[model samples]
Target: MHARIADRGRLRKVSTRLVHEHQVIAVDALTVSDMVKNHRLARAISDASWRERRGMLKNILAAGPAES
Candidate 1:
C-alpha cells in the first residue's frame, strides 16, 4: 500500500517535470488491453504503468502551467 502511494507520487512528479521541460509530448498508440492479454508481457506492462502515466500527463496538460 505504502509502496503504491510512493510510486504514484513519483510518477506525478516525473510527469510534471516532463510537461514543464517539453512543449509537446508524443506517445505511441498502444492497445494496452490487447497487450495485456499476452501473459508474458502482462506483468511487465502493468509494472510499467504507462496508462496511469499517460493519464497523468493529460491531466497536467489540461490543468495548464504549474504555479511556481
Candidate 2:
C-alpha cells in the first residue's frame, strides 16, 4: 500500500513536469487490454502502470495552465 502510494505520487510529479516542459506530448496507441490477455506479459504490463500514467497526463493537460 505504501509503495503504491509513493509510486502514484512520483507519477503525478513526473507527469506534471513533463507536461509543463513540453508543448506537445505524443504516445503510441497501445492495445493494453489485448496485451494483458497474454499471461506472460500481464504482470509486467500491470506493474508498469501505463494506463495510470496516461490518465495522469490527460488530467494534468486538462487542468489548464501547463506553464510554470
Candidate 3:
C-alpha cells in the first residue's frame, strides 16, 4: 500500500534531498506495462526502482508546494 509507512523513515530525507537537487522535477515516467513487455530491459528497469521512487516524490509534491 502506498499509504503504508515508508521504509524505516529514510524515504522522506532522501526524497527531500532529491527534490532539492532536481528542483521539483515533473518526470515523464515510462509506462511500466509496456516496459515490462521487453524481456531484455524488464529486469533492469524494475531493479532501478525509478517508478516507486517517483511515486513517492509525487506524493510529496502533492502534499506541499515545494519551492527554493
Candidate 4:
C-alpha cells in the first residue's frame, strides 16, 4: 500500500490499519538496533524498516484512537 509514499507514512498507515482491524497482532519484543548490528543481517534488517514498524506497533497498541 506504500509503493509511492515515504516509509514513515507507510508504516503509520499499516500500523493504524492493523490496530483497528485486528484484535491480536503479534509483535516481537526483540531489540532491533542491537540485532541489526550483525553484519550478515544488517542489509536485510535495514530494508525491512523493522525499527520504525515496531515503534508504530507499540504506539498504536499502547494508545490507540479514542472510543466514540
Number of the top-ranking candidate, with TM-score as the measure: 1
Residue-level lDDT of model 1, residues 1-68, one tens digit each, is 99999999999999999999998899898988899999998999989999899999989988989541
Q: On residues 10-45, what C-alpha lDDT tens digit does candidate 4 reach at each position? A: 788888898888889887778778978999998897
Q: After superposition, how far is residue 68 of candidate 4 from its true place, in Å?
A: 12
Clashes of each: 0, 0, 0, 0
User: Where in model 4 is the C-alpha error above 4 Å?
Assistant: 1-5, 31-41
| Residue-level lDDT tens digits of model 2 in 37-56 | 99998999988899899999
Error of 2 at 42 (Å): 2.4
lDDT of model number 4: 0.79
Predict model 2's lDDT versus the native. Answer: 0.90
On the 0 to 100 scale, the lDDT of residue 3 in model 1 is 100
TM of each candidate vs. truth: 0.85, 0.80, 0.58, 0.64
Model 1 misplacement above 4 A = none
lDDT of 4 at 42: 86
lDDT of 3 by residue, 1-37 (tens): 4444545256666776777677657678578888889
TM-score preference between candidates 2 and 4, better one:
2
Worst 10 residues of 2 by lDDT: 59-68
**Positional deviation of 53 in candidate 2, in angstroms?**
0.7
Task: Give Cα-based local distance difference scores for all models.
Answer: 0.91, 0.90, 0.69, 0.79
